[model samples]
Every structure is written in C-alpha cells, then in structure tokens.
Target: MPGARRLLWLIPLALVVTGGLAAGATFLGADRIESDLTARTRDALVAAELPSATVAFDGRDASIGNVPADQRGRARSVVLGVAGVRTAEVTGQPAEQAPEAGGHVKRDLQVRLDQLLAAEPITFQPDTAELTVQGTRSVSRVADMLTAAPANVTFEVGGHVARVPGGDPEGARTLSEERARVVANKLVEAGIAEDRVRAVGYGDTRPRSESGTTDLDRRVEITVR
Candidate 1:
C-alpha cells in the first residue's frame, strides 16, 4: 500500500516535468523559425533580384516614380521582385517636393542673410548702439525673417555683450539692453510690428562658445513666438 501511494505522488511530478519540456520545445522552435525567416528576407533584399526602384511612401502606400531617366525599367523590376514588398505604384510627376525643388531658393536666401543669433563678436561704434556694416546685415536678416513670418508672429530680441577688459558688469548689462532696443528699432523700420517685439540683454552672462575666450562674446538673437 505504501508503494502505491508513492507511485501516485510520482505521477503528478512526471506531469509537471513533461509540461515544462513541452513549453521549452515550443519556445525554441518558434525562435528558430523566426531566425530563419529573417535570414532569408535579408538575403533577398541584398540580392536586388526584385524590382529595384525609388518609391515614395505616403503612410499607407508606396508610389514609384521615374527611375532616374535611365534606370526606370530595371528599378521597377528589382523593387517589385523583392520577396515580401508589394508592387510599387509608379507616377509621372515628382513624388514630393525636395529641399532643392525651388533651386535651393530658401537656402540661397538664408545664405545671403546673416544669423541674428551668432557666436561671432560684434562691436558697435564706441559708446553708442550704432551697428556696423556686418551688424546691419545681420539685423536686416532678422527683420526679414520676422516680417516674412505669419502676420500674427511675435518675437523677442535678445542681446549679449562680451566681457570687456575694464568695463563693469552693471554698465555692460545696461549697454546690452540698449543695443537690443536699437536692433528692435531697426526691425520696426524694416516693417516688423513694433507691438510684437520686446528686448532683453544678458551682459557677459552667456559665453558664445565653450573653448574661445573672446572671439564670440557679443551677439544678438531673435526668438520667434
């Protein structure tokens, strides 16, 4: 009778061991299958046997376009032949406007202009807020960006000053503020709304760059709102 009772106990233990082994086998089989499929897909992509083409994806669908004038047919064949990829819908017109669509118009315009916020140090006429030629160009570009923005756009003019050899911090702050106001006035003259602009100055508070000491200390930036 004791042996029969021990046999009953062993039955449950055996069931538990068999269940664990089944679960482990299932997991390993799934992993191997997934790994094999991934390898095949990667190899197929590298082979370029499917239709190869430049296609544009618009969330739901991909549309292929003229394949560089010379490789259109081959591109279509290659891209389409890929194992899992859906056939691409081809189009005649441009898929989407590129950054270079307008002859790089925006970039050209920005290049001709100057960054209102710069690390380069700019000095005004001695003791006055008058901007030199380079400063004027920078200020003009800022004005243009502001005015060209939507009519309801607002901006803040931030001025920074370099640490002068003998100047006091307090005076520098005041001067920087004055310079900021001067820039604001120029923007107004260039057709920006005066009511939408405010000015603030940081005197020797923010350095231009981490490495340099004096190359880029004084500057200005226009924050768009």
Candidate 2:
C-alpha cells in the first residue's frame, strides 16, 4: 500500500515536470515567436481592413511595406496598436509633390526646388538635422530666392530623409523637421518674414533621390503654400 501511494505521488510529479518542459519549449521556441508575431501583425492589419499591407518583423519592430503614402499614418496606427511591436514602419511609394500647389510643399517644390538647388544640393549629417558648412552655403542661395518671392506668397520648407535599414524612423522624422526649421530660420535671417515661411518634414516617406539616401534626398525643398 505504501508503494502504491508513492507511485501515485510519482505520477503527478512526472505530469508536472512534463507540463513544465512543454511550456518551456513553447515559450523558448523561435518558430513559436515568429508564428505569434506573424499572426498578431496580420490579424491587426486584417481587422483594420488593410489587406494589401504586409509586415516584416525584426525583433519586436515591425516594418509594414506596400502601403500607400496617403495611408501611411493609418497603417502605423494599426500596427502600433498591436502588442509586442516596438516600432512600426509604413513603406510604399515615396510621397509625390502635389498635383497642384497649396497646403502641400511637395507639389510646389517638385520643379521650383530643382531650380533653386540646381547648382549643389543641401547636405546634412548622416542622422542629424544639423547643416554642414556646405549646407549653410546652399541655403544662402535659397535665401536669395525667397527674397525675390512676393510677400503675398508664403513659402514652405520641406525636409526629407532616406530610409536606412535598421534606422530609427522617429529619429529620421526629427532630423528632417529640424533641418527644415534650420533652413527656414536661415531664410528668415536673410530677410524673409517669419509669417511668410512654413517649415515641415516628410522624413523618408517622400524621397526625391533615386536611391533615397543621396544629398539630393536630404534637401530642404521650397514650395509656395
């Protein structure tokens, strides 16, 4: 009877050990994590009705590609709302200059900015908003252009960045915005009224350069707004 009692205790103990091993295997499994990430990402996209968008997971960061530029914000919102995602990247075609000018700096600068920066593009630090010596010189020319611009017209300085792999999207955004502001401040110092200038950044979303990481892409584009 004592042996029978000990056997019964051993049975429950073995079950507990087996259960722990199974649980540990599931928790420590790479396939399991990947499967979970994929499911969670896809479910969020589907729930948001974003069938066309797909997410790539790197650690906890999710890069969602094939999203339209206009829908980028919604895509990010959807993915960031998902648990276990650290950062979200919404990528697709680079944003284009507006079909016509007004409110959108992209549209206004497509042709006009080229005319201004035709000689040399403005250059910034690899991951910063700081202007290089050459960058400051480039903006001096832009100041001249703004000086000729009519006071009735307002100009917006749009900043851009190339999406570097593993780069921080938020950092890119901050750099771009600060770069625009830098150029805008320089133009103001050059005699443009503060009220007549608007500064904005589009980060890596609206790449003008072919490779997206050229001095050309990291430029301050001027648009009549």
Candidate 3:
C-alpha cells in the first residue's frame, strides 16, 4: 500500500516534468522559426541588391523600405521565395533621374535636389516631419542650390501627385499637395528665403506616372518657378 502511494506521487511528478519540457521545446521551436524567417528575409533583400535594404516583417507580410535603383524586383523575388513570406511589399521610391536642363549653378542645384529626393524620398511620419538620412543629404544639396542661385530670385515649391485609379482623386491630390508643403518646409529649413519659396500641393492631378498602379505614380515633384 505504501509503494502504491509512492507510485501515485511519482506519476504527478513525472507529468509536471514532462509538461515543463514540452513548454520549453515549444518556446525554442517558435524562436527558431522567427530567427529563420528573419534571416531568410534579410538574405533575400541583400540578394535582390535593393538600395534601401531596410526590412519590416509583419508576420507573413514583409515590407522593404529602401530599394536600390535598378534591382527592386530581383530583391522582391528572393523574399517571395521564402516559404513563410506571403508578400514582399515595397514602400519607397526608386533612385532615378528624369533628365534636366539648366545653367551651371542652377543645374548643379537641381541635380542636388534630385539626388536628395531620390535618396531620402520624403516620408511623413508624425505631427513633426523629418527627413531620413538620405533626405538630409538631398536637402543639404537644395540649400546649396539655393545659395548658388541668384540671391534675389523667387522660387515656388509646388507639389504634384499622380492620379489615383479608381480611388479618390481629390484626396490623392491633397496628399500630394501636402507632400509638396513638407518638401518646401525642408527646403526652407535648409536656408532658402521664406518669401522666395512657397509650397503648393497638386494632389493626384499632375502625375508623372499615368498608370497610377505603381509607386512611381505617387511621387513628389518640385518645380522652382
């Protein structure tokens, strides 16, 4: 009878130990899974040769922020190949130029601004807006451009957006306009004359990209008039 009682005690003890082992195993498994996913996703981004290799993984949905100039798709495909990555979403602009024409100083400044926009690509985060590292570089170039331009020249910082397909045209326009405003503010902070610069949002009305299906359609254009 005493042995029987001891056996019952051992049964409970064994069950507790087994339960703890199971829990520990589950935790380790989960951790391994997450680590594997993160590693694979990061590797895919590197393989894609994406410019901005910043990745935001939300479960099955993975988003890349900084794509290099000419290899966005290649990078995206690598991510898609990962078993758990359901989608590889790109959330930034490409680093490209749309040609240019201006005198030495003006052309130089314009090129600088273009470089900034291409690298930083204005991102509106909160009540207070700030430029990314790339933005800072580009804005510095614009400031240089303004300094290089005629001291008394007046400039208009206009905003423009690509038209949305089957979406709210007015809303898109407003957003683009606001984006313009933000860019203007950055330019002003970089030392452009306040009176010389003005920001106007065009919102999806004047689109550089007509299709409106691509991220390029949603862009910020700066026209210094």
Q: Which model, 1 or 2, shows the larger TM-score?
A: 2
The Cα local distance difference test for each model comes to 0.60, 0.76, 0.61
Prediction 1 TM-score vs. true: 0.44
User: Cα deviation in Å at residue 73, candidate 3?
Assistant: 59
What TM-score number comes out for model 2? Answer: 0.48
TM-score rank, highest first? 2, 1, 3
- State which candidate, 1 or 2, has the greater lDDT: 2
Q: List the residue pairs that clash in candidate 3.
A: 48-75, 50-68, 51-67, 51-68, 52-66, 116-138, 173-203, 173-204, 177-201
Off by over 4 Å in 3: 1-136
* Candidate number of the best lDDT: 2
Q: Backbone clashes in each candidate structure, one number apiece? A: 11, 3, 9
lDDT of each residue in 116-195, candidate 3, tens digit only: 66665543432223344554465566666664465445566655555444767677666666766777776665555566
Q: Which stretch of 10 consecutive residues in model 2 shows the poorest summed lDDT?
A: 94-103
Off by over 4 Å in 2: 1-113
